[model samples]
Structures are given as C-alpha cells and as structure tokens.
Target: MHTSSARDAARIRVCHIVHSGKVGGVEVAAALLQAEQHPSINYQVAVLAQLPDGEPQAIKAPDCVGHGLNNPLSVLPVLKWLHRNAPDIVVASLWRSVLVGMVAKLINPKRKFVIFLHNTQYKNVLDRAAHRLGFRLADGIFCDAPATRQAMTAELPLETGQIHVVPLVARGGRSRHTPEAEQGPVGAVAGGEIRCVFWGRLAKQKRLDRAVHLLAELNNRATVPVRLDLLGPDEGELDEMLRLARSLGVEQQLHWHGAADWGRIRDVASGASFFIQLSDFEGLGMAAVEAMQLGLVPVVTPVGQIAEFTSDGVNALHFDSAAPVAERMLSVVGEPPMWERMSAAAVAEWSGQEDLSTAFETVCRQFLANQQANAANHVIRGAVS
Candidate 1:
C-alpha cells in the first residue's frame, strides 16, 4: 500500500467515510465528491452502516464500498480495508466517521485525515470530547456553515488556518423556475389555502409536531384553506404528528404522504407554494435548499445554515422557532404579495448559487490541494525526525 514516487503525478486516491448510505446532507455531499471525475484525483466512498434494502437505488457512485458496519466494533473491518487500500487522503463526513478516521490515522500516522463538520451538535461532554479529539487528530476541518466552523474553533481551540468553510454542494437537477415562469398560482392562492410542504425524517429532532400545532392554530381563525403535506418515512413520530393534527382539528387540511422517490419528492416540492422546516437544529437544510430551488417560499427558523443561504426579507420568511409560528404562517398566507416576493427571491437565490456541479468541483479541488500539502508536510517531518 506504500506510495511510489512515480505515481505522484497520477491520480491521488481519496476515500470518503460516512455513517450511513441513507439520503441526507452529509451522505449526499460525500456521494457528490465521490462521483466527481477529475484527471488528477480518484475518489472512493465507504459507508459504516449497511444501506437499507432497495433504499439506495438513487445513488450513482458505483465505486462506493459499503462496509455494513452496524456498530462500533464493525469499524475494525473498515480499518483493515483502509490499511489495505491506503488512500492518500480520507475524508470523514460524520461524527462517527470522524472517530473511525482518527483511529485509522493512529494506526498509520502518515495518513492524512480531513473531517467535515456537517452539523452543530456539541451539547454533551462526550460529544465535545470526541469533537476535540477529531479536530486535534485530523489535518484539516471542512465546514458547510459559518456556525459549524465557529463551534469547532470554540470547542477545539484550533487555529483559524486549519478550518475551511466549504458550502455544501446542491443536488444536480433542473433549475426551478421563478413565480413568473410558473404557469399557474404565482402566489398563495386566495381563500387562505396555503399549501406548505415539509420533507424530512419524522424524527424527534425535526419537531414536526410544532408544525402540526402551527397548522391547528392557523385553522382556528383563518378563512383560507391552509394545508400541510408531511413527506418522509413514517417513523414513530409520524403517528404522534398525526394525533397532534387531529387534536388541533386540522386533520382534514393535513396530508401525510410517506417517503417519496427523489423524482416524486422533487415534483411534489416544486408544485408547493411554501416550504416549512421546523427543525430545532440542522447542520445544513438540504431539503429546504432543494425546495427553495423549486420556487417554494421557505418559512424556516434560523437554525444551522438556513440563514446562510436565505435572507429574512430577500429569499425567505425567517421565523424564530419559539415565536408564534402559526400566526406568522397565517399572516403570510393572507398576504399574496409578500408571498410572491419571497417566492421569486427564493427561486432567484437557488438559480444563482445552487449549481451543484460548480460547487462540487470547487470543494473537491480545495480538498485535493490540502491533502497534497499535508502529505508533503508529513514526509518532511518524517525526514527531520
């Protein structure tokens, strides 16, 4: 697995490690990096957990290796694989992946490890410790949002030079048209029926119950038809959300469409008038970004990097998660002009900067350059020592 001097000019092997092969921000980003084709670099992916049966049909990276590691002990197999393959650089896309990458680097100190911080979740002591250890062991840190980078520096006390802010690459697809380009329903339809679409796992962290309650509140006084479409896998939280919607007497207005295929999901999102994301926290709101790209006016809280891509009055209608979300939703639904402005801005923003190919190439190039420099530094240190 040792590198040959003659191979220096050839493609450098880079491996991306992720916790799961499921559809998420981190996984999508890693897939994009792996799928990128460049003359100077070759990419591979290793997933810690086995992808769900028939769930990963959408992923196009053929070289991605699924280790089927269901637990911490399963990481040993990954370590062995890494030892044999000996990637010039390893990029860990999640916390668990970062831990595994750090351990792999310890096994071979010459290996360069770069960690991508996808979210901001440093609440407990153990989480903080793991984050610090990963920061200290990795050669560089890549962050999608400013908040994530800030959290890393605060917790790890790393020098600013070691932190890199690379925005997440958008999923490639047709650019969604602006409201004017849209054929019908340019704004919130009259009669107060605001069609809001929410797409994500129905997990506790997502706090979809809050959205249900908001719909209930809106139904109390609103004359317009306010409908909410819940799209995602039906986890335990789905039942609870349904109960909440019923209790709020908005059951008739709420539609539950279980997990949809990517194409179907995009079609559903593109047809929606508004997109609502009520998650308490997020590393990067990929669904929100996708919805915005499709001309859906985003009504999201300022959590994670949602604010990074969206301006309060420019592209989205930002709301505090703790504030009167339902009341605000009603207000927006009642004002078609405001909705039109926000929807137009949302489409404009996505069209302007959410180009997946460009963003992916930029991050890949930066990562490869960093890895080359780190490899050279390791060689120099070894010679001196």
Candidate 2:
C-alpha cells in the first residue's frame, strides 16, 4: 500500500503489520491510528492474515494489505511486499507481527522497527519467546498501559526512553449526549427493568460465567427485572456459559449479540444500566471505555489499567466478589440518585481521556526522529574513523 499524497511525498511513511485483521482491540487501535491522518506521517496496514468481510474498520480500503497465513510460503509475499515499499518505519503490533517486522528489518537493516506490546502477560511459552525476540530487535516500543510498560521493563532488557504508554481512547462508538448531559434524577433504568451489557470475546478470561451468576443474584435481590446483553464472537466459552445460564435458570434473561459493530453495540447499550467486564486481566479495558461513552457505568474488577481511571462509587463500581458486586447493583437499583451520579461520572471519565490518534502520532513521530538521529550519529562516527 502506497500513500499517493504528492504534496506529502516527503512525509515519514509507516507500515503497521498485524497478525490478523480481526475486530479486536489491537486491530481497532491500528485502524483508529490510521484514521488520525497525522500531517507529518503516512500510515498503511499490512495484515498477515486475510481480512474477513463486514468487519467494522476505519482503515482505508486502498491502504490495507491482507494475505492469508495458512501456508508457510505466505510470509514470503509479505517480505517481498516490504522490500518493494521500503517504509521508513515498520510498526509491528503483537508478537506475530513483530516476527514479521524482524524479518523485514533483517532484509533491510536501515528501516527502524517499532514494537507495540498490548498485553501485560504472555499467553504461553511460545508467546513469551516471540515477545523476547521481538523486543530485542525493536528500536522503540509502545505499551498500551503503564502496567504493561512496567511488566515489559521487568521481563525485557529495555531502556527508559524506549517505551511509551499511549492508552487507547474510544473512537468509533456513537454517543447521543455528552458526559455532561443531564441524566435522569431517579436512575437510567426504566419500567422496573435494568439492562446490563458485556462486549468482548466470549472466553474464559472474561469471566462471563461469573457475570451470569451475578445476574441471577441481582435478580433475586432487586424487585426489578435485570437483563444482560452478551456481544462479540464466541471464543470457545459459549457452550459452557450457556449450560451455566440454564442451570441457574437465567438463560432467558441473557441476550447474545455476536460480533456487532460499534454503532450497533452502542445502540443496544444506550439505555443500559451497567456495562460489566469481570475479566481476570486487561491492558486498558477499551470496551469498558466504549461503554462509558454510551453512559453505562462500569462494574469491573480493579485489574490492569482499570484501577487507574475508575473511581469506585464515584465514576464506576468496582468488583471484588460476585456476591458483593451484585449487592452493589441492587443498592444502585434502589437508589436512583446514586445510579444517575455514577452514569454521569462514567461518561465524564471517558471524556477526560486523551484522543488516541493524536497521542499515537506524537509518540510515533518522536520515535522515528530519535532513531534517525542515532543512525546519522553512527554514520558520522564511521566517517570519522
């Protein structure tokens, strides 16, 4: 993919390589960064895997390159493509993309390699090994949260200025009112019904089963009816979660909306009482931020970067135990004033975040300029010798 801007021909060109073009946080962030249209930079995405149809993406059609990774020979074309385009900076997101970028760097050592690490912990031994190798070859690094930066610093041999924490802000979702919009004095819920939402892959780490349990407990305690909307594609936990919901007799209350676009999710969640994510771990909890933008107070465990922005009882509710979280839900259900305050606070918290695209452009431009200086200095030393 080439940036055909003749006026901006001298601008820094960046190629972002991703493992896949799926609708995940990493992919979404890459898409948002491309949409920023930084004046000094031209951005394109090279997806390692074939892009599936109908995925809600902000990336321009002409600027994206996708090649399916089924065959071992698949990477050869990507390497060839890199050689043809020769971007000034190659930004690799995730470990898989890092490996691709490493090969691209080896092919042409002059190009700077930047690694974007999204998670605090590795998924397995293979992931750990890839991350170690990727970081070793990276000229600069981007971390989604301060927690991820600290974790990578301890695990990898990284210098202080190499890592930049640029948390992803909500970009795609549609919100009708501003955070300062006046919420109902009584509460967001209406007609004795409380609607809750959870969006992300339906996986074990997300603790959707725990959310189902909380739903049952909340229904038992509150006089109103509580419903939960489960969004995102299933990641092998649907069957088990469904069985649990059946056993608990709350299957009727749980609505499953798989892999929805941002607008659809926001539309479904507009009047929802709470957005719940009981995940065991997270980097920055992008979905929760999106939920907050929709004016739904978050009920999340204080894990990952979630603890940094969310103020329990002020902006959002915190989770320690399912029973306790359910109790808090009931408390809010009864106290309409408290519910209104939290709803407004949740939106306000999201409103205060930095625009992700602007932050990323600043960080990436600085990283490239610094790397160019180092290269020039090395050349000067060689000439002196």
Candidate 3:
C-alpha cells in the first residue's frame, strides 16, 4: 500500500514544484501534503521563488532548490536541476510551475509531467495559448476545482479524460467523533458572538474587501460582537482593504494580521467559530479547508471550488457573489443555534473529503503505476514486433 514506512519497497520518486514557499493556500497545501506524503514515495519539492520572509522554512520541499522567480532564465536553472536528478514524476503547481514542468519535460520525455492548477484560471487569448502548450506538454492534468477542469478541457483540442478534478488538499484530519455541539472550548459561544476568521493573501481575487463588507453585515445584525481576523502576507493591498474596512466602520472589529504562517494562524483560529470567504472565486481554498478541519463553519460565496465543498442550508451558507454581501452574511450566522448546527455540518462535510496527504500520495503512486504499466506494454509490443 506504500504506507509512510514503505520506502524500502518504493520504485518511484515524486517531486512537487511550486512558484513559491510563501504563505498562501497553494503553498500551504503543498507543504501540508508533503508532510503527510507516504515515505514509500520519495517526496520532494522544487520551489521556483525565494522563500518570503517569516514563512516557515519547513514548508519548502525537502532538498528543495529555488530559482529567483523574477529572473527570465529561472527556468533554465530549474530545468537543468530537474534534468540532472530526473525525478520519476514531476507535479508542477500553478502557472509558473506548469511552464517550468513543460520546459523540463522537453528535456526529459520519460519523466511524467503533471500540471496541477490550483486556482481559478483567468483565461485570455494568451492564457488559452499557454493552456494549449501546457496540454501538449503534460502527461496528466489535475485541477483543484471542477470549473477549473472544465476550463482546461473545454475549447482545448486535448484528451479530456486525462483531467482529474479534486478539491484543494484537505489537511489535519482529526477524529470527527467530537459531537458538533460540543466541538470547541466549553462556553466559548455563551456570549453569543461568532468569532469569525479569514486567512488568505490580500489580493483582488481573494476579495478581502468583500470579506470585510460581509463582516460589517454580520456585525450589524449580531446579538453581540462579530470580530474578523484576517491572517496572511500583505501583498500591497492590505492598506486599501483596511481603508475599505474603515469606511464601513469595521476597522475596530477587523483584525489585520499582516503576515503569518500556518501554525500561528491555525492556533489563532482555534477560538474562531466561523470562517469567512467571499472571494470572487477560488481554486480550492486551503485556508477555508484548514478552518473547516478545525470545525469552523465556512460562510463563503459559491465560486470555484467553494461550490463543491459548501452546500446551502447544509454545511455552509452559500451567497451570491453579486448580491449585497452583508445581507448574505446576516443570513448565515444571525441566529446562534443555526450557526452551531452549521459549524458541525462544516466539520462533517470536511471530514468526508479525502485526507490531503493521502490524496496526493495516491495521485503520485497512480502516475508512477500507470507509467510502469505503459513501459511494460511497450516492451511486450517491441518483442512481438
């Protein structure tokens, strides 16, 4: 089964390549999955950019190498490194990594190149062109959301069967046996305030501003206080988002956690009962998934993978991205009892998903196994010929 201790039996090595080891959903997912990957699979990472300051060093791939992301010739060095080592399978994540994988595959044809797109792809004419190029280069295609898979497969002259749709990897699988009603610290919610949390980069796609507006909405109708804690690296828009939050008078209620790693964010989120995500779209939000793992109910608009994980009146409160953001927030957590039930449901639904590490490990082994079978078939056919 290629368990964590089955390394002695492993016949293949897998390398995961990402654009950076910075504090974001994709980077964090890569790190968490890497940690959980089975020992039997020689798991490694190739980071394409320098590790940002304050991000956990452990998140970087083991024996990982990085090429300065801004440098045009970055691919050449990475391509050379991968060529030298020649991992059995190279799973490249995000856009840059996909390009890196495509180039590296040209030099090492036998090496399986899997392009893992973990975000809502913005496809223009240029993007579609690159998609075609990626399709031509990839041995396997993985998209974090069904929409992403559709985008990759639709209008592209490629084998759609190769595309595999899955959520952003789920991390920290815990015993879901804890009754939802009694999941968090005792008396944590007695005050009637829903301690809400949000974690992600301060980018337009994340719609941090929309998230703040949602908080203002929740606060307006709250029986008590509803505080929002946003934890992530500030990618220059934190000030603008903060101004928006201030404009709404939620500056006091909004806690801007400029930049933080997973450990600190998770630790801080322990006190939070709800996770807020009102992004325009997401690939598969690792932040939202991590919060769900901790039993926090997600109140996210149905966009990208959010639709796949969240169900209205069920596990999560789904809102229209185009609707009044605050009005939607009010519906999700206005009633304390409703919030409690939703929280439990969120944990339950999250637990139903495959463990992040296990899912990644399975994917790696599947690629290697398929490669082996194809090789054996080629040999058999050669002898017959």
lDDT of each candidate versus the true structure? 0.68, 0.75, 0.68
Per-residue lDDT tens digits for candidate 3, residues 1-385, read 5565465445456778887777776776677666665545566677877775555543655445565765667787677667666687788876667777888888778778888877666635655565567778888877776777765566655442456664564443442222355333211242556677887787777777777777777777666787888887777778898898889888999887766765577676777766778777777676676676666777787877678777887776665652464555455555667767776776676555665555666666665566677678779999999
Per-residue CA lDDT of model 1 for 183-267, tens digit only, reads: 2222344353567788777777778877887677767766767788877765579778878778878889888777655556666
What is the Å distance of residue 162 in model 3 from its true position?
A: 2.7
Tell me each candidate's TM-score.
0.81, 0.88, 0.83
Top TM-score model: 2
Give the CA lDDT, 0 to 100, for residue 51 in model 3.
Answer: 72
Q: Which pairs clash in model 3?
A: none
TM-score of 1: 0.81
Q: Who wins the lDDT comparison?
A: 2
Backbone atom clashes (below 3 Å) for every candidate: 4, 0, 0
Q: Candidate 1 regions off by >4 Å?
A: 1-9, 36-40, 56-69, 123-127, 172-192, 234-236, 321-337, 354-361, 367-385
Determine which window of 10 residues in candidate 2 has minimal summed lDDT.
178-187
